[model samples]
Target: MPKLWNETIDAHREQVREAIVNVTSTLVFEQGLRAVTMSQIAEHAGIGRATLYKYFPDVETILRTWHARQIDSHISELTQVRAGAGSPGERLDAVLASYAHIAHQTGSHDRELVKFLHPDERIVNAQNQLREIVRQLIEEGATAGELRDDVDPAELANYCLHALSGAAELTTAEAIARLVALTAAGLRPPQS
Candidate 1:
């Protein structure tokens, strides 16, 4: 096959795979995970069962892929927020706020669905990525005198993640913001 044809085929395959993932996610979200079947997903995705099998062996595989995609998207969004033009303190605030918002939204998902998705290694890797991002920001802030130097950056990073994880239980944007503010406050240097 010509190079252009090969690239086109690859792009088409990716689009089909993404479509299947999206359809599976919608079915799982709207119909509940247990109620969603592979046949239903294949039909809803407009692909034959055989084609769906080529992409995913079972409903669980499809759901896992969808969850992995969501994790990637969330990480990418936070990376952008961290990279946005701002002072280190301001960037840190933005990143924390973005992360808290995601946690708050995810908290509303069905408990069963959350449980199903939470055990994957991808979640652990994503968390480690999130920690690294926050750690780098903390180091920047500490060096800039915006955050306390008394605490190690890695320790502060862990503290920030654990503190903000509580945002999952928060009910309102105001509450989440308050939580983020309190977490940020803990990072601030003490006055003489």
Candidate 2:
């Protein structure tokens, strides 16, 4: 198919997915994950239960799918950050800035996203992956003399990535700036 035709299909898919996501998020936020049944999601979305089942067999599946998608989106975003080609401090700052931007975008007025990712095993896994990536980024920076050599990159990455979970509740760009300051302080090269 032509690129335009593919784009149209993708657009439609995105719309449908958004509908599903919005309805599920609302239900989860209002009623808690266990209370939000697939039938409820179907009714909320104005789709048949069969259609809902076709998209997601169970609520856990929906949560996992959404979580994975969120992770993949951020990973792809971080990949772009990596490509910018800068010093450790510059690259780290850019990455943190991008992360803060994504956090703002992911924040929902209904508080569904926090309910989804809040302080749980699923979130732990997501943060673990993020921490690993941050560690790797720091390692790269350290090798390039962009970050402090003495601090353990893994430890610092865990601190930074874990700290970012608060972005769910934070409403302003100032929150991101605060995080950037914290992250930069942790990453700055120690005086010899």
Q: On a 0 to 100 scale, what is the lDDT of residue 19 in model 1?
A: 95
| RMSD to truth, every model | 1.5, 4.7
Per-model TM-score versus the true fold: 0.93, 0.69
lDDT for 68 in candidate 2 is: 67
lDDT of 1 at 6: 98
Number of the top-ranking candidate, with TM-score as the measure: 1
- Alpha-carbon local distance difference test for all models: 0.92, 0.74
Model 2 worst lDDT window (10 residues): 108-117
Question: Candidate 2: which pairs clash?
Answer: none
